[model samples]
Target: MFLRIFNRCASTATASRPTSFTFPQRLNRSPTAILESLNSCVQTDGGNPAYIFMDDPFLIPTSGHEKRQLALSKAS
Candidate 1:
């Protein structure tokens, strides 16, 4: 979660600040509201693992359906 910006100030006055320096980049200040955002696409699928075709009932995770949901929200 880090961004590196490399710039060469042409003069000493530019490097030294008399006023506050705003970051040339913006950071995502919002923490994930849920743990599902970090998981793979499959984990968030909302389906019954028990009745599903999968053999190991617990092999697949059935949780939040927000994997692509978040992407669409960001687009708007």
Candidate 2:
């Protein structure tokens, strides 16, 4: 579902074509855009504490949420 939406949005940007995607302008390529990009990559913990702590640095409400929220709020 997410990949489909992402592809649609991305293709819309490139639909004009021949201009080429540019860094800092392209979605998910900027430093500030990374948090939004990573939000979609989160996976379920499956009841593993170690997996929650070690394997998921970007897990919301565990590690990256506070910092990501702060950064995004500050940007706005």
**Top-lDDT candidate index:** 2
Clashes per candidate, residues 3 or more apart or on different chains: 0, 0
Encode model 1's per-residue lDDT on 25-48: one tens digit a residue: 866655763445555444644644
Candidate 2's displacement at residue 65, Å, is 62
> In candidate 2, what residue range of length 10 has the lowest lDDT sum?
48-57
Output the number of the TM-score-best candidate. 2
Q: After superposition, how far is residue 58 of candidate 1 from its true place, in Å?
A: 24
Clashing residue pairs, backbone N/CA/C < 3 A, model 2: none
> How well does each candidate superpose onto the true structure, as a TM-score?
0.16, 0.22
User: Model 2, range 1-76, lDDT digits (tens) per residue?
Assistant: 9999999999998887676666675454667677866777887676654422443455434456765665566569
Runs in model 1 deviating more than 4 A are: 1-64
Clashing pairs in 1: none
